[model samples]
Target: MRECIRCGEQMKEGCAIRVEGSATGIIMSTKENAMFSGRIGYPKVAICPKCGEVSIYVENVEKLK
Candidate 1:
């Protein structure tokens, strides 16, 4: 479970961060050349309902290493 940084509240996880007019979500990579790198994963988002704090994270963190 994710916690809010600003307020002491449990955040809503498993959210997607997509472009304004696109269906594609944000991606994160460990290597500079993300296209050719296998160490890339979609980022998950967490939002705090209390303080409106947003946090972005990768669920498959092992892939980044």
Candidate 2:
């Protein structure tokens, strides 16, 4: 359980949200050049139902590399 930073209320652990890197325009959309381009990151999130606040953090930053 996590605490809401704004409302000081106990927050509930939500689902794992998938996060991916993005680029603007037509830079690159194919997976072939993804290695030299964007990166992948997965962050665990917690939500406060009382205040509707959200908090996101990466449990293992090393995994992003």
- How do the predictions measure up, each by TM-score? 0.80, 0.50
Per-residue CA lDDT of candidate 2, range 23-59, in tens?
A: 4222222245673445334457788889988887655
Candidate 1 segments exceeding 4 Å error? 22-24
lDDT of each: 0.81, 0.63
- Model 2: CA > 4 A from native: 18-41, 61-65
lDDT minimum window of 10 residues, candidate 2: 22-31
Best by lDDT: 1
